[model samples]
Target: MKNAQKPDHMSLNSLVNRLKDGRYVIPDFQREFEWSPKDIQELVKSIFRDYYIGSLLLWKGKTENFDALSCEGIYGHQQNGGAEYIVLDGQQRLTAMYYAFHAPEIRLPNRANRAFYFINVDEFMRENFDDAFEYHYQSKRLQRLLDSPKAQYESHQFPLSVIGTGGWDLLKWVQGYTKFWEEYPNTEDDNEDHISAEQAEVYAVNGEQFGQYIKEITDEYQISYIELDQQLGIDKVCDIFTQVNSRGIRLDVFDLMNAMLKPKGIQLKQMYRDVMPNVDWVDTDRMNVYVLQVMSIVLQSYCSPKYLYFLLPGQLKPIRHSDGRREQEILVQSTDEFRDLWDKSVSSLVRSIEILKHPNEYGAISPKYLPYASILPVFAALESHIWTLPALERLDGTRKMKHWYWAAVFTNRYSGSVESTAARDHQDVQEWIADDDARPALLMEFENRMRNLDLSREVNTSSSTYTGIFNLLVLQGARDWISGVAPQFDDLDDHHIVPEAWSKKHLPGNTWHTILNRTPLTADTNRNVIRDRLPNQYLPEMFESSGEESMRSILASHFISSAAIEILMRRDFGPNDFEEFINERQRTITDAIQDLLIHERLDLSPRLRELDLDIERVELALRELVATNLEDDSERIPSGVRQKVQQRFEVAAKKDPSLDPENSRQMSSLLPHFDIRDIQDTLTNKILWPVFSSSFTSKSDLDLKFSQLASLRNGIRHSREVDDVTRMEGEASVLWFDKILTK
Candidate 1:
């Protein structure tokens, strides 16, 4: 306090102007710009969510101090105005804001491409934080979209670059967007590019709403900063800067909340300290914040940072009634109530951690290999809620919780928007537990995601899917080849099945590092038995020692098929043989994942299974028929159909770059991109109808069979509970397709 003035605040609008005016400078000794694109996106999301982004520490510097420190303007800073303050802290936050708002044509640190940020209006309106903010590298496609007014209106993206110039630029862009959409409603021709008057009005309204909201946030949001007096001696300033940088600690939300609770006599810091040791087994530094998150979830069924503030003892929390009415309710009206809730939340967190660590439950083994630590708050809150249910109901709730947990992990649901995801999952899973029919959308999402699951691409040890697969193997009681028993929790290690040493020599790149090629084994077994040798070299030895049946059983526990073992043990084992083994193992893993996702009570009957198989065969037959008939001439396909399929492939390529149309595995045909709906489009195309007319009775008949098959395929794909009558209809349609396509 001797050298620094009290913390003061300014509007975010003023902050941006001051930054552009080059009033604040970074000292040469400060760390370089280090925020990645993801970090920048999160900062933007925080700002829009109205969460505090931390205060800055700046030294009011004299000319001599500036010269001595060798300070310079922030990166991409254009104005040469003399520096008024030398920033000691918050450099990364300030620079990220400048880069995003300024939209400088420069690459991010350690990145090859220049980053561009945009707010997706649709996602923002829907409150989907995960997709609300987006960043993309500068590309021709991006440029074309940005240049086209129609495209921008259709995509509902508001570029953040206009913010740095001034609010006027944004206003003008919004006006232009609204006018363009209004003028081009396309009533004359109802084509793909046309929109109805109703849609045009909606777009116009959204554009104005987006602009006004951004302007309000920019103009009203306050940024706090502490200013050190220039009168302070140079040594004192230098010492202060070093101390601030070296400590690497900031007062986060938990710190602020702790102080807020003190006036209410809650002593949150003391409560957290008492509870921390119990949850110390959870390997994360943000345990304090997680505790608050758990409390938020339990109280309001929401734990986002903004929602956490509602946990204050006297806060008037809004409650919506089942009859479409809302009212204010004091969530924690007294200190005693707050303490009771806190104690119960801590107890629930302990129970959740125990369940996670237990081998038979989630099989996370330890906090070290837990797929997603971020999901703990929701998991704990749900556990607390479930404990309040009747004994018989509690058992059912726990089983469903296990299924939801795996679905969340395999879908990577908590990768971003952790708080929002937590709130939604808590609510959805609770509903699902109470009602058998109220299956959460996440289950269907998981099924769709698993249908596309390719384990060979899961290379990172920290990824949810990668760790999830390992946990699945652990839950399977993966017995070590050497001991023929499950390894101790600490002794278990994920070792490469094909041997990293051999794969490094025979395969290209990091293909050997995939989760498909790795499984749980004892560390001792990895070092002593499967040491740097090919599977063929060592597996045969294991088979002889353990007997073929015992070896197959052990491998089955690892999600390794017997067929894969046979391929690995072939006398002529080579890279191709290795490929076959990996493909088969990937299938085995996929099947296990599918099995885990199925509801125990809603198990598919044999008729439903046959319908699924028949649907797959029909897909393959269509692909072969298209390839044989069209000679793989993609250009001959209808422009609309080709474009739609191309869009699907492009979106798919984001998840797996190998899903390109050029990829040979799709059989050089467009059929792979064709869902049952898309298949209908292709079959009904006027240009291509002649080729298909010979196989089908007529276009109407083709439509009837497809409508039935598509409905049934969707039911299977989405895991919707089906009646016997609907199943019969689906089977009849599948038989019809088999009869027609086989001809």
Candidate 2:
């Protein structure tokens, strides 16, 4: 029962004309259009140059419902009933055509005088080069092709690229662009990536545009291949936008969040936008995208696509919704509650992440959500008695508060209905009150399990320390997330500690997952000291490029922190350290548990039951390991292996001790067992002969040994052969500590 498939074709002339007069729209249900004018203009220039590219997105429908925010400034939509297609993918590129052909001047922010540039690199272009023209555009290339377009168009056979500047810089740039595109390259009859003689001739003539050029390209070469399908809608539009765009070149959630908040009222939306970015850590640092994620979670809790809105700063209207009345109602309903909740939560969360200092771990979890847990603080601030169970039980007015909280986070973390509101009420109705004996026991059981899970997952090498920061809040109640923050010990890099570098080496997979590679240093510091710098003997008295004082301050500040820098200086320089290859995102499990506990407590019952049973087993086993005797006479661990392993663990631990597994038993449990055949006698403990120890008393002491772990790790790396003394010593100490803890 589906409509028959048909291929609909519209030429470049019809598509451009349709877009020019505003006949097509992106649709109301579509995601908000976000493309800088410069990015759009560049793409437009590409179209005129006749690049080896094809396809324009066209939705097939007549007067379909789309997002109201999406319809603004778009090409006109056709109502001619026969399979009208919505422009889904090329919204940004198409919008550039509007500004290029229509707008007198473009409006954009944060763009300095990076002017528009057009370069004609053909053999003929090599001569028309003017030194004065070069100085004007800030490029050493020819200008003045506009004056004699015909002669230049016939002569030049080159590829053209146009760049539009952010500000008045574009004036000089557009002039340069005019010269560059004047020469058209020929059309290729071969593969799109390959160059051909026909293409060269085509590109030289039709490449540059100025009203007339659009006509010429339309006549000689270009045609729009409109790809159409039935499943074209708002979601598809958003998904495509997200996919095709690069970071910082697309619409951010904060922008969308503000757009969504607009439904509350422009005043509220503006107020939130103006104030929300003031945090020194979030904005000025140019880091913490987790803040954006929180905004999305918060927005979702309020409403969905049709009714929701965001009021971004500087925009006259709501960015998310066009309907003011419905938007205003949602805004008024959501803002007050969200604000009170956010204000407290952020203060606590900021401190926690800074203290935990795990960028690699918390990279996926947003810092904005950190404030969700602060709902208790908000409640505590507002009413004071809401903390007690009897007071909580008597409270039905707070049900809405609970509802928003659950939807924001709990819904995403768990796969159960046990944490739902229905389940919470069921418990309340059953009299699990404070005075009940069952209540105290339940509280103890809950807290004990939480403490164990927190200790395990938060500091585990594989987890993002960012998630564990919340535990820091619970244990050491800091007023601000950064207040208790220690000096940048230089032990852990927020990654690329030296900051400035050519490029991070390409790993075929996700580079950010590695925690050993991740660091907690500020963006300024991180950017300055990028991966691969062999730490100079001393950080200079003054760094010339950034001219920032952070380097000088950190160098003189703390002894332990200073010592960490020394270790990094002596270590080999490479971006692909084992530290960066992070695998265990162990805290996600706790993140789920904590989120469920706070948000949808009732709906998470089944999940909670599973966690309870699993955690109990882990607790008993850990305690038993701690209780075991570690004295072993049968086989002594080679001192060389133990020392090597100890150093490696210490190196990363210095980067982030909180991420280092807790307790000697926990640390010892992950070590590789050594045997007599594994031990090879060598030099000053640098390179080691392989030795798998036959017997060891400690459960997992090997996991925490840094030196042995790295050296024994089979990799194409260079190292001086190591000795047996340090290895045995490290293993013996691990065994000794395990014995001590057990007794």
Candidate 3:
């Protein structure tokens, strides 16, 4: 690194002249132009008020290296100097100033077109200022006001383009004002003419003051810059750029990478742009970051979140070679090696994207639902091996890859510590491919991680987890509830089954927004037909119009089983029956999630069944233990324990169809009948723990065992999968009780 020059203040006029003469260059490593109209307006206002706008950092580089820029219109006559100054910091501020003064019109990020104008201070102060002397002059808002039909063009509102071009002087401005008065003259109304004369008198008296302010803004306002010597390297320059921009959006790692590769005659941006159009499913603007991330991962096994400087030529080396040259640590010496790495990395990225789009694989139709973008690099790392192989030869590997991907999705393995998880998984998956014994272990690890994930829990529509599963369901041919047509992801709106208005009035708090009640539909169907109506009312009408086949299709699309639909068909629209309907539908959704996440996995199914059988045996043992121990003191249960037992009993009692003769038989058959004695008969170890003999020495230890058993029993009875840790604890508790019974 070379020593930087001392900071110096330069006038705004001189800076603008440098910009116009193409003396200032913006390097390709700089971020794209992103300043909005509001940003520009505020910057102009600050400069007008003579506020300090901070310093700029510039690198004095050779003219040949400054051929490309992130944006245009900063070019004019090139100076005959030996070296030019390239802007490394303050690009946005300089770009805004240059466009405001020189360009004919500038387009904003929101696609709004605007032109800059000098403020009419005298007229504005005379007509709008109060006694306090504070005035508001928002540039864009004021420009819109002046452009309106009812507003007259003021004499002082000169276009900035003409002012910076040396075409307008004070004498010419005065002549233009006189010509304007001659053209429009005065209205016949005495009051209007009197007001016009008052405005004219104020402008005439303060004309010199207005000219002086304009001169001060255009010529005298100073902008400070810290200039770096031309001898500095790209690495040092990138470091300075990143350090100075710590407060705002810092430079992307890809930006630094692009600069490092420029000397080799390779452009990272153009390479990505050329490959982007080939992948039609990707939204280029949104997924560009992921693509760059995948490239980094393919080149190096790990991606550092902060920087990619380590991947440059002198920093990294190939560990091994195809020629068995393991003794030598070979640096990336030639452009050939760089070009080969780029091609392989991009090929891996394209393959990963294709795999995501495969309907039978992850079924990721879009990037909208990608919960962890960090996982994409893992895919790239795995897919890089199959790049040279044909598609048919890679089938088995792809299948194994998809299993891992789905396991990651359901288990949320990449959720909290994303970068570290991606790195670990990348190395693990690579090692598994090399060693045959590691494959089965990897699959088992995936199964264990996924065992306890409760997909039945309600999720909001905007949640990434919910969206991921929803997209997968749609890709499996889920149809719209109204039209029975496969709905497009972008076109679908999340529709509430039992409309929110009626649910709030009848059901529990916000129960209508749960995953079970929400499904996708076309915007027209959601807004026009399903607006604020009960399911019983609209569903019956839909059935009548669309017939049974269509109605069943709609129900199935939302993962509602035929049995649940039958119960819904017979239910009444009365006040208290909606909760029962939601419960039945929720069970149906749980079953669908099980099938989607663990479809046709024979090993997982048998393990789940065996786990459930063990839980049932533990529940029976607990009941026997409670009946034997608590027979003499059944009525002495603690208040807290009794309250929990009563809550469970009340819930079961409400679903007893005998209480409501109008309820469906299917719902009644699914629910258990509970009486006061039933609660007393099956005493959980949690409630009767103190009554146990001194053989169970530690109450805390026994409490943990009973808690695990209770959780396992509830999950088994309610058709949920038990997690591995809870299962192990419950099994150990059952064994301890069994030994006591045998003794």
User: Which predicted model would earn the best lDDT?
Assistant: 1
Instruction: Write down the TM-score for model 1.
Output: 0.75
Q: Tell me the TM-score of model 2.
A: 0.25
Instruction: For each candidate, give its TM-score against the true structure.
Output: 0.75, 0.25, 0.45
How many backbone clashes does every candidate have?
0, 142, 0
lDDT of 1 by residue, 392-486 (tens): 57766777887898889988987776888888899989988877656777776777787788888889998989988877777777899999988
Local distance difference test scores for all models: 0.80, 0.36, 0.58
lDDT of 2: 0.36
Cα lDDT tens digits, model 2, 395-447, are 43233233333332322222111112222322332333322212212222333
lDDT of 2 at 193: 43
For model 1, the superposed segments whose C-alpha errors exceed 4 Å read 1-8, 27-33, 56-71, 82-89, 139-151, 180-201, 225-246, 262-270, 315-329, 601-743
Q: Top model by TM-score, which number? A: 1
The candidate, 1 or 2, that scores higher on lDDT is: 1
